[model samples]
Target: MAHSRGKRRLRTLVRNGWISDQHGAWPMVILPAFVGAQLAHRGSIAATADTLAVIDPVLATSLPITWLTGFLCFTAIERWALTPKKRRPSCLPAIITWGTIATTTGLITVIRSPMLLLWTPVFLPLFVAALWEVLHRRPRSPLARLTTVTAASLMLPVFALGVVGAPSPLRTTPELWRATAILGSYFVGTVPFVRSMIRARSDHRWEHASVLWHLTSAVLILLATIWGAVSWPIGVLWVIIACRAWAFPRWQRAHGPVKPIIIGMLEIVLSIVLSALIILA
Candidate 1:
């Protein structure tokens, strides 16, 4: 009976596009989450550990639940948008998604982390805009994609602040917003680079523009790091991104398109490296 129930759950996840097809979404959430948590702990995992020492591990562990909640929330909205308009209500996915959201919110309330609550004001409008985009079934516009990716990037710091028990934007340090920009730059820059590489490959104008965009991004990140807006390690990431903008597309030209799985793996590695550096910074 338990085995059959597990199979049913697995089938539901697969039917809802929540399984392997969604692998690309994880790093987008994970990296920023790491950056936020690290920033909240001031780049020290030990600091977070020391602070969480007094708190319940259940709450500490609920960090991942927040990530799941965010993903489910977005996925639900997407699914809701995709559902055909029928007079007969057939909204099982939406029901499950809302159930998950409610359960996650209960856990968060129990945890008593206010950082996430503070961020909700900023997160809600962006989320609604995403829903609107999907509802209209418009092709993913660059600006909309950028906005969504940038919003996902912010989740990390918010979750990180919660992990370290930082209260409701009480401190408002330079590091707070700096972390967001530093992380936001990399993910948002990918929009142009990706366009130049895969989507707009034959368009010379866009390709050149993409290269220029990445180069400018690298230079700006370098200037910001030199100005001490963010740590030097993050600047290293920009250098790599700049090189990717210039080189990765060429490699793809010769190799005939890198597999999505391979790209996802590389991104995971990049995320790990970034997280490690921030933790040690």
Candidate 2:
């Protein structure tokens, strides 16, 4: 019985060490990268039909995979590092394993594409802010959450750089920034929308603020469409997101608390739709 209990406890620790409980964060990390890859594929086709045809399949596949692995490892290490001091000793194995993987993969990626280092200036401050939040135990603060969302959104350009087979500075193209803005706006708006539902559910002000933010996002996207900055499809998607933001809280207020899984599923569907529209448009 003692041996069986010990085995179970070890299994639980290992599982908790490897898997993240922050389910909402996965989409933020993944969707931007997916959008970037699709956009790059599209850009390559537009630039030259033979562009992708000539590129090495291994290279095209490996860069993003390696980068993503390194990124996930880093995040896992960060999560472990943030554990309470008394619990941190138990997290040591996870931290060391993830840290090693993160370092090795990160080095390989940077060596393969040295130009990626150019993003240092962009990411450094955000990293600092994120670290500050972690140290201060304010990871859920609006500023901290926005900082994280912004960092994730910027990965779109990073993935684009890998797929488009170019090393140009991220600022060279307006389209990259524009797409980042569209994606970032949705994620930033999510911070408040989620807070209104869970953490600040009793605060009417959060609901109002969330509605206002979504409406503003929808209007801004509409204006961008009118200005020919983005296509109408993206504008329509923003409007749909805005409606979701407005309607869901009222439903929750009347019906009582909704299951988090249902909320997560709805966001997943919306994220898929958003990614598809962005790519198609």
Candidate 3:
């Protein structure tokens, strides 16, 4: 039964301009409507409420469009660059790179200085690419990706608790401990889990990508938590960077990683600038 369904789905995709082996090989305006809705919900309604003391019809009207565009962007990236296990490139390099990013982000947040703020934007691409590994078409165990996301999500809330429980703003004791605990936990928990997930990946292209992508996101998550729990809100840039994963090339290029690396650095710089301005203001 499963074999037949797989065959059917493959046929449908191939007929519709999808490549035989790409992850999201067909161009689609993917509508991850739910997640998209969540992203715009709070901001739009809040903006509207502050004006008319109620929900603005204009804001509500734009919500679905915002979600559709974002989803389609991701879909386009997937269809172009990714494929299944049979045609995968080297997953090790990508996975290792993302892992390093995660570890570094975790380290920065824990032993945080202003430099950590510079790294906030790179978090997004790292994260989204890794997730594409899992979410894209491949035989990798989605369970592994699910595990990483679930555990990490739980840690974010835990860190928030520590922050919320901190001394009142009137007090002199700065809330550095929140950073220490959350970043530490984020680092420690992520390493073992990512290692385990990578081991479990079936050497498929998408699986390998997912492993790398998740590791990157895990690091970004650490940065985001630190900003949320202990420092300035420069982590918002991290979210933007992660979203850039939807623009990844169809395969990991063996040539210079010039473009991606440069983009990543640019994001970090943007975060630094934003942070500096906020602090100065």
Which ranges in model 1 have alpha carbons more than 4 Å from their true place? 1-12, 17-20, 41-59, 83-91, 94-99, 102-107, 204-209, 228-231
**Clashes found in each candidate (C-alpha, N, C closer than 3 A):** 4, 0, 17
lDDT of 1: 0.64
Better of 1 and 3 by lDDT: 1
lDDT of 2: 0.75
Candidate 3 wrongly placed segments (more than 4 Å): 1-7, 14-52, 83-195, 198-281
Candidate 2: minimum summed lDDT over ten consecutive residues — where?
44-53
- Winner by TM-score between candidate 3 and candidate 1: 1
Tens digits of per-residue lDDT, candidate 1, 1-281, equal: 99999999876664453442356566777778766665555533222333432333544567667566656656655554565666113445554765586577646754576445777678778777776776676426665676678778877666656665655454445555666665676667666766666667776666677688778878887898898875787788778867877887788888787666666676567667766665565
The local lDDT score (0 to 100) that residue 231 gets in candidate 3 is: 40
Which candidate has the highest TM-score of all?
2
lDDT of 3 by residue, 55-125 (tens): 23433333333323333333333433344445433333333443444454444333422332332354355
Cα error, residue 181 of model 1, in Å, equals 1.8
